[model samples]
Target: MTDFNRDALGPPAGLVATMRLLLVEDNARLAALVSDGLEQQGFAIDRYESIDGAEHAQTIAQYDLLLVDLGLPDGDGLDLIRAMRRRGNSTPILVLTARGGLDDRVAGLDAGADDYLVKPFQIPELAARCRALLRRPGNALDSVLTAGNIVLVTAERTIRVNGQAIEATPREVALLELLLRRSGHVVAKPALENALYSMEAEVTPNALEAIVSRLRKRLAAAASNVQIKTVHGVGYALFAPPAADE
Candidate 1:
């Protein structure tokens, strides 16, 4: 089963200063080098070794782009790309397969790849292509978000849990925005602290927890079952999304 979330369908954000990528190459050594280099360039990179990892990733996380190698132990990389598109996923994808023949390139594009690169290629070239893919429109999540049963628009500073609009304080909106972006992932305290205030911005103790409590109550009042959940010694996550049911 495939899950579709509002983040996937929402409008694209303005040009991102940083990006997150899903690298699906099985070779451990190459994957490390690529992942490390991308991290150095200030991009968050997650690597998976098989098609199952890719499938789990499609539902469990989000990506600005996918760097896939054609030859994998599980199955053809093109097959995965086609399946995601069939499910209405349109994140920009670039093929990094070992196959370079014209037919192979044709196959990747026909399978919905935006760009294709033969393996043994220059690392810089691969990075450059990834940058280009991010530049394309509709590759990022929507600027606003719908958390639990509530809809929050950052641009308008308004929140509507179930179609009835209400005012959300700037701080409240910020908190919801962070949780929504990382809908299914637990956000640790340190990260949430950082999100609340930039490195230079002043932050106070218990500020984050207090905000989460307020948001949780608001969501419950909206007839939503506390989508934001806390994990002991960990952090919080928006536990519900379009795919949460699946």
Candidate 2:
């Protein structure tokens, strides 16, 4: 039996918007375990048993990070990684495999994987490794985000308005992080939905609206100069309200 190290990973602090991941593992049992564990740690996971499914998914959606197993049914995971690099895709990839040989690790890295983790490892360590990769410069998930009077520190899961700390629910923090990162531009509704919830989550039609409403109230009560404007049938945009003098 594989030890998941769930206790060590602990509960994810819902600090930033959920990071989406593509997991390519042919072992059904192991795939389920990894996906569930990561989801508990605030990551949205899309699992595929083969390279073909994963390739198809990439065509429609973007993933923050990829967890791939070397032994796939259709092809080698390294091939997929190499293809992604060849096409100029810099999305971070972490190789997860049972092959622990030194040469194997070197090959994985040479093929463009940012990190490699041998199987039968602790889930906490895997989660930490994923965070390390995402922290690398130019990744979609940043450590800190700011807009107008709002400042959010993703690492610490803290948000403040004009230096005064403000409390926010996990969902509120997730929504606020996405909005703050793309401040002044309308973030499409589907994109926001993907960031806020996992594929397996049962989200109501009004789920996003509820989160937006709550975050709006929090900012208002904190006297934030920033505002979240609904585009109605489009999406939401966060921007600083124009100065009174203007």
Best by TM-score: 2
- How accurate locally, in lDDT, is each candidate? 0.74, 0.83
lDDT of 1 by residue, 1-246 (tens): 222122323223343445778888888888888877766555667788788888898687778888888787899888888998899889999998778886988889999999998878776567667866787423234455665566767667677866888555577677777777666678887888887787354567988888888877777777764378888788888876564742
lDDT of 2 at 123: 82
| Model 1 Cα RMSD, 1 decimal | 15.5
lDDT of 2 by residue, 117-231 (tens): 9989988688778987777433334677766777898878899999999999877788888887677779999998997776355678889998899888988999998889999
Q: Total clashing residue pairs per candidate? A: 1, 0
What C-alpha root-mean-square deviation, in Å, does candidate 2 show against the real structure? 15.8
Worst 10 residues of 1 by lDDT: 1-10
Write down the worst ten-residue block by lDDT for model 2. 1-10
> What's the TM for model 2?
0.52
Which candidate's lDDT is highest? 2
TM-score, per-candidate, Cα-based: 0.49, 0.52
